[model samples]
Target chain A: MTVPDPRFSLNQWTTRHWPIPDLVSGCVARGVRGVGLWREPVAEYGLARTAKLMGDEGLTVTSLCRGGFFQEKDAIAENRRAIEEAAELGTPVLVLVSGGLPEGSRDIDAARARVAECLAELAPYAGSHNVQLAIEPLHPMYASDRCVVSTLGQALDLAAPHPPEQVGVVIDTYHLWWDTAAYDDIARAGAEDRLAVFQVADWVTPLPEGVLTGRGMLGDGCVELRRFREAVEATGYTGPIEVEIFNEELWAMPGPDALTLTLDRFAEHVV
Target chain B: MTVPDPRFSLNQWTTRHWPIPDLVSGCVARGVRGVGLWREPVAEYGLARTAKLMGDEGLTVTSLCRGGFFQEKDAIAENRRAIEEAAELGTPVLVLVSGGLPEGSRDIDAARARVAECLAELAPYAGSHNVQLAIEPLHPMYASDRCVVSTLGQALDLAAPHPPEQVGVVIDTYHLWWDTAAYDDIARAGAEDRLAVFQVADWVTPLPEGVLTGRGMLGDGCVELRRFREAVEATGYTGPIEVEIFNEELWAMPGPDALTLTLDRFAEHVV
Candidate 1:
């Protein structure tokens, strides 16, 4: 059988129940070479231990899940800790989910401005840590309580104030598939060198309660996965394609089983 | 008490359980001079009969609920009938919810293309009937199963090929409050004279199953309802402000009580 694409990386949230050690071993056993980690799991496993585990398994840390929630009271300090974690793990990218509007405030502009301010304070720290801060524009449905950055254009705008290597944007299919200008924005992201991470997750209907978990498995929904992958590749991005689905079913499966299935689907729909 | 604004129109779907007759009397009692209608109820109550009832009550039909669902096999014929109904009811606008991708299909581009083609066929007919086809871009959450058009910008682009008087866009606060580019698009719509209808409904979190009917009461959610009204007015749109909410709790209220509550909230949050 043909091997999985070397650039295919499994995001920790996809198989959330998978223990860190088993996840590493599962990737190695399946010939997977990269992983996108979450800060909580890394912290839980002990940052040093998680980094050593990846090294032992010959796995590269493709990215760290998130760092930006600028609306919080101590956003800078929290983000600094996240940046330190990414640096220690040797991950080049730190995904940012800019928080939603501040409580009881309808002033999205102010909240967005806060994100910019927090970024200014953290960009230098991230640059020094050698981690690229990847601002992820979530789906507009989350604009109220999750992330106010709701378009690739907005994400790129947020990243523009920083150095290309210092700040970038993530292209996640689940959050972006509905955008009519997504293709144009994707091209713009590539041209501006702001396309820091490429994430894959299909969007399914009847979005579950809270609209958080319930992402469709690869090829299970309407997203044109191959087209997105092709677009990112055309932009000269030779980086890991992180499968970051947050479905309950996928998390409930045995870690090895889920990895194997993901590899197969990745080969079929994404790579 | 101050009289309710004459431009405030109640969309039938907002108080869904209220029979058409009760809805009419309720509006007339409240001095509500206009009503937005849904095709199913109008048909169930007999279209011509409903039209006559509105005329007899001296209430105007502001707009018709929908026309486009182009993915269906009979979409063209179906939309033609809707245009005819709007004309018969003497309403100037027929809102269109461009249907989502075909079942089990991953071709959203094709679905969107179908909507444009359907419009190309129906726009002239609608114009001939003295009805403008107003494309309502549903929230992105419904991009897969409900409507492929997810942004006001996209709707405006689709309406661009037609005459402004023949084709226009619907500005729904619930669907668009989260968009960063919404204000600019509103100005563009006004400048282009394509802002055919203005709708208002507050957004609440933890969207109920299907994400269709969880709209918050006007003052119950975080949306800047008055700001949206001002924005639309700034666009020079002097059309009726249609309050179209879809919430189970609101529907369960007595018809007159719901109307009273809506008027109060409209004044408090949207005036």
Candidate 2:
């Protein structure tokens, strides 16, 4: 049983190779339901202008791509700014890829502690603005210099200590398909009513650039997407299953073609 | 206190570019204690000649490089040959990288079932030959297509259905450091008296080919080598630590230089 597409959201970066109006008109013309954008694209288009543009196209801003990077000392002010922006755009969830191990810090536990403390402080400000903070666990290969929340279990452990409803976790397959704990974590999150988003991507070989460039488009690698969707759905998470792939190749392709391909594959495999 | 050098065993392939006798002589001249020659080397040198050469050099075959690939239809015959090879080398532990999912099969759980069942059949043969089988939990990236056992916990679980003393697991850093479950699994294995083998290697970025040729020489990456050594040592299994890296760049270097580099790094980071 395939789930119907939410049909509109265009992650701005997905269309970064294209212009904002092009992406909006493309989505609106094709009956896509909403848009998920980032700070830079919104800034480039001017936030209010972007908001007005989305409003004019009847597109909902599902999420804003960022806000955390809590491991850095200067992260505080920047994160505060992100919260303000999310409030401005009225993004329901502000996705946060917590920064990796601080330079010269060998202690991962301490890094986790740092992120948790930072999030606790940031969460209240976000809650006040009704902007939910979602922690995204990047892959473990990124443990040293990227997100320290490398597993769903670790993310949940960090999240459980915070207020239940104000903060949650984002399930991005590219960052997590390798995790052995994923199935359990997805169910656990849904049971807790905190599965903010479920994202899909594949795991291709010859990992490019080592960080973000290697994210495979859906069905391009070995991930069992339907099983992941089943795991999430079994927990009653009926919300949008976000297709948020960070693929250099796909981005280079025409935006509409990529969206069409993603939607087509999403329907066939992930739902 | 650091343990004395436990005879450097030449993992046959480490010096595949050289003949078995010459590789052993080179290792012995450099103060290496042993050589873990493979079946191909033994076949070329003649098993008796290989054994005599190592015997003449006062080297110990700590463990054979491998034995398992047991998921095949012809597994019993293949495993029996592996037993004979281990017996010939007088190697105590036959390292087994429990291979990845079988082609035409999508159920990883079922693939794991095949491993356990095959191991049960192979265990009797190994026991008869007094050959200990060591399961290696390869890195999770290799989980889908290389080893179904991707964590020490899963390896332990597979081992659980067998005798702890006969069936053990190799904690190879190159295959396992990224695993968050390593510390806990090592501790648990130590408690269970099943800490089989400890292999060390560094993880260089942009993992070469995503298959082979990317393993860093020890001390080249951010792996907490000493921390892992301490964790494994706490398990009371202070066996020889093997430095195993399959790097094309290192391979291009003279074998003796590579050996020296590996040994020096082992002393500084792992001893």
Candidate 3:
């Protein structure tokens, strides 16, 4: 078998049921060098232990899953904690899924404003931790109950005020592939020096209920993965390309098998 | 109870199973003076017969359901026939749900280019029929398999190359609500005189599978219906505000009851 691409990083959520210890071993067995981790799992696995384990296994923590959700009452405090966690884990990036509109509220403008405010509050904290806050604009379907930030353009606009070292943007293929302005925005993101993380997942039809957890495996749907990768690379972004599929079927597979499948598809469709 | 808003026009798909005759009589009884027609039901009831019936009942045909599916091989010929049908039905507006990328195709740019080309070919014919083709951008979630046009800005851009009277854009709250630039685009649509139709359907979450038929009733979701209506009116658009919903629950309700609920909600939440 061909050697796995050096830039390949498996997002922990891709193998949702994979135990932390086994996942570390699986990555090591496959010669995978990086991992994108989630907060809940790391907290459950003990942050220091997870960090020590990754260090022992020689696996780099590419990023922490999320930090934004500004609509929540304690969002600022929560995000500060998340920033500290990222610092402890040795990840340079903390992905932010800025929360959706407040409950029963139609004032999306207000919710978006809150995200900016929260970001300003957290950017300095993140900067002190040496962690760049990567604002991830989710697909528009998640605009109501998930992230109000729904396009790369919006994310860049929101990140504009902060220093590039403290604030940046993620270019996730699944969420952004459908946007007409994505490529243009990708170039703008690069020009602005806001390219922080690059995640890959395909866009499949008949989105499941709640429109979450249905992200297609690499090459299983219609996203132009390689084109997206090339676009980011063209922008001079040589970051870890995290394979972040959130499909039920893929999650059910053995972690090693899933990683094997993802590695193969990554080579075929993304690299 | 307050009389139904004169501008409220129930779209046929809102009551999918309601027979044309029953729907027509129900509107008249409820004091609703306008309706948005679907080509399928109109054809099933005989287009000429339906037109004559609406004329006899003194109900104006607000707009024809759709005409553009540019990806289909026979799209041009089919749209030409649709223009004729709109003319026969005496509707001045034909809404276009531009189809998604051709099957298995990842070239969205090419698919979008195809839409522009098809519009150029059909605009003159629609103009001749005294029918304006309104480009209706579906929600971005539908960009893959239903409609590539997914924002009001994109719709207005597509309609820009043609005469405003022949080619216009639709403002559907459900599809455009999540867009940060929607209000600005609405103003642009007004200044350009390209606002052909104003449609309303609140956006509720946990979208069912296929994501096609889960549109929320007006006051039932987070959309600021009155703000959207006021924005459209600010554009100097004195056209019908078509209530176009596609929910399985709403469709299962008895026609008159569904119409009653819609009228009540439109008054409470929209006008």
Chain B TM-score per candidate, please: 0.99, 0.94, 0.99
Number of backbone-clashing residue pairs for each candidate, in the order shown: 0, 14, 0
Name the 10 consecutive residues with the lowest summed lDDT in model 3 chain A.
Answer: A205-214
Model 2 TM = 0.92
1 or 2, which is superior by TM-score?
Answer: 1
Off by over 4 Å in 1: none
Worst 10 residues of 2 chain B by lDDT: B1-10
Best by TM-score: 3
Docking class of 3: high
Give the TM-score of chain A, superposed on the true chain A, for all candidates in the order listed: 0.98, 0.93, 0.99
Sorted by DockQ (best first), the order is 3, 1, 2
Of the two candidates 1 and 2, the one with more favorable DockQ, higher being better, is: 1
Better of 2 and 3 by lDDT: 3
Error of 2 at A233 (Å): 1.4
Give the clashing pairs for model 1: none
Q: Which stretches of candidate 2 lie over 4 Å from their true place?
A: A1-4, A7-16, A209-211, B1-4, B7-18, B39-48, B70-73
Q: Evaluate model 2: give its lDDT.
A: 0.76
Q: Fraction of true contacts kept, per model?
A: 0.79, 0.21, 0.74
lDDT tens digits by residue: candidate 1, B186-268: 99999988999999999889888778888998987878888889999998889999999999999999999999999999988
